[model samples]
Target: MEQRPGKREERKVTESGHRRTAVAESGSPATGARIAGLGAYRPQTVVSNEQAAADAGVAPEWIAQRVGIHERRRATGSETVVGMAVEAAREALDAAGKDANDVDVVILATCSLPTAMPNGAARVAAGLGCRAAAGFDLNAACAGFNHALAVADGLVRSAVARNVLVVGAERMTDWVSAHDRDTGPIFADGAAAALVVPAIRPGIFPVAWGGDGERADLIRIRADTGRMEMAGREVFAWAVTALTPVIRAACERAGFEPGELKGFVPHQANLRIVKALGAAVGAAGSVTATDVTHTGNTCGASVPLALHALRQRGELTAGDPVLLLGFGAGLSYAAQVVLSP
Candidate 1:
């Protein structure tokens, strides 16, 4: 699992009398960066609509019509955030024909880590045997994967690193309350990862990201109770109306028309939001990812998980343009277009 011959060592810095490892950075711009590989991991335990409805005190049909989830994965005690991230990262590295040590940076996008002391990325890097890699965490809620992808793109373009591993992993069930129907059946657990490396041509486009901190309370994890809460209808309305501009901006940045995209992979919050966003963008010719039908709302892991599923189904192929939009908690949102790997 060592890097190939002749790779540079990762950077370390001494600042303010404290020492720390850092992702290598150079002022010179690179040729570009592309997603070289992708992978995903879902939990073993599956919860059906009937099971979820019974727990939520609702009808199975009501659950189906409301969120469009038939079933979703629930992590067993044996499965964990770091472990799932490692599994997905390993598969992504294998798909990219790379070894763990080849990575110089690791970025994990998540919001549901049980404790906040040591970040999950460092542990994941350690698990993968990337002893020299600089690791960090990012929290943009459902928009996390896309935000991390954008950061990876900029890092590569600015010569911050030659190889970056970006992973989105969440254990959302921990934040959700079983008695709260709004979130009980909606949130699930999973992880997905992508490998970004320098490329001769642009495989990733510029990202368009923004947030409305004014509406932060729309989806919040109560500090006192540590339970997740949401204003479902308001959030849904905001997403359907406010996000299309973000989508259009990303397409404009990529020099692509919506009709030219091969696929659309938005966060799998629910099916209604997914379809509304798709229709708003008029991506009639693109294959829209509906992984929420099976995977439920995985929050941070939603985008990459859906992207991996699309690739597996042969709905997207190398060099095909795909639009990715992620919006959720934080009242945050980000969008980008990338060439499918």
Candidate 2:
């Protein structure tokens, strides 16, 4: 007898030395998965370049010229990472036309949680009323959102979950010193989310991801001071020189060229890096996100938040192909092309 396309049978020897035929179960009916909705939450408190400059011992003009940031949002005491994630998740659920009951899993992507005791995803799931949804956290630093997005795509397509809520939230202010010129003005606080669901056609494409553990020391939080440290010049050099191939690989995986992209949403790290990467990829015709100008680098939340900004501005339409790239701390990077929801 012939087997079904997705089913397989294998003969294996058991521990007792008995040969048994094992059947591999088929996955969900989904051919692929796509992001059904996207939502973002920017903290209410806005920090201007003047304020950041005062703390970093630099002039406002210097910041603008160096990083291309005029202002950024800073989360207050009430805006915990879990709380912001919940807010963003609720908005994403609403946008997806789904309720808490529809979610089977919740993945929170973040790196700024104060402690590792109780994970943030559980609280996020509880806050969103997803009582039965399994929850966990994924930490890839700034590349976290893109990483979680790829995982969500797999979960949905493989029948592991019918719907996955992927949230990227951060309170970078908690980890970076306000007085550190390297990290202070660049990092900010925000949250964004995406609802992944089964689709007849793939909306989320393959991811080009990698890490450089050898360069982990380029960006890290010091244990002694409990503050974040960064080798800005080194990081910038690595990003521009190394990530162009990643961008191209992602586009090729999606069956498109960089020039064919309608939008380019890289992590909102800085204006210079964003532009250099964009140019190297030859995506000049794309509507590249410059969200860093206002949002700063919200770490994991940067990519999704930038995507939301483009949607809000009506720069992206349904079915438009956009390349999303995220790279940062941990020396991690991931890129993929996703159709605008």
Candidate 3:
């Protein structure tokens, strides 16, 4: 018998005089990584501005003028965060022509879980039937998806994972007070996912991420009340001004000018901030996503949900250069460029 080159083999004779052999296996690292597919799931129950405003003691027009959200999804009793993630992931895997066995890792990005114990990622993996896939949760508030995406890119390029499933799922209603006008109308529930795979040419570019701990108090979950609190005016100001530079840096790192972008998908924080940031970055020619108008702000799930909406509308074409930005509580922010899938 002959041994193959570049491979090591060990041979030993057993006490019974039988021959035994062992060989070490290795995987070749990928040159880059790309999003192979995308999917999203929004709850069936719709909360109209009129309904939301009645609880907050405001008029429907006020909700529309303030957040530009006429309606948003509210998860039902059966729509758990992990359950929504599984549905989104299944659609993504199908779109990528993959199955549960194809997933090497599952990253669930969220900040609004019912409880801290038994992370949602593991449950999501189990629901998807990805029995052997590595699973974990990542929290960067609304920026969670972008942060998870960066991690997935590294895993694929480093040969740590052949296919990485990144899902952003949130049940914001669980953390927000329906009677609190400031947080109620602006937050919603939904989930979205992206499947990343090894690629010969990079599709997911470098991420430009940073956090402002100094402004962490701007948005938070009040320890005493166990509800979300936000300085709407302050967050809006910071997003329009501070996030412009981050978006530019991401495009620069990807070797693309703002004018070259085909689409811009910022966190569906609010319609005002999304439009302001898109214009400030000079992505005039790009189709800007206004998913917030219908989906409101889903926190961690916003970015991927917005992207999926664009794809469904036929506003994004395959291989088109799209810039994604996510920012929220923790005063955290992240931006990146990815070719449309």
TM-score of 1: 0.93
Clashes of 3: 0
What lDDT tens digits, residue by residue, belong to model 1 across residues 1-341? 22322234454544442224333332345667899999899998999999999999999898899989999998988788899999999999999988986887899999989898699999999999986788999999999999999999988877667789999999999999866899998999999999998776788999999999999999999999999999999999999999988999999999999999999999999999999888988978899999999999999999999999999988888889999999999999999999999
**TM-score pick, better of 2 and 3:** 3
**What's the lDDT for residue 284 in model 2?**
67
lDDT of 2 by residue, 1-341 (tens): 21222444243546663334322245335677888899889999999999999999999999999999999999999999999999999999999888986777899999999889699998998999875677899999999999999999988777666679999999999999888888899999999999987777899999999999899999999999999999999999999998989999999999998788999999989999999988888976799999999999999999999999999899999889999999999899999999999
lDDT of each: 0.90, 0.90, 0.90
Error of 3 at 316 (Å): 0.8
TM-scores of the models, in the given order? 0.93, 0.92, 0.92
Model 3 TM-score, all chains together = 0.92
Clashing pairs in 2: none
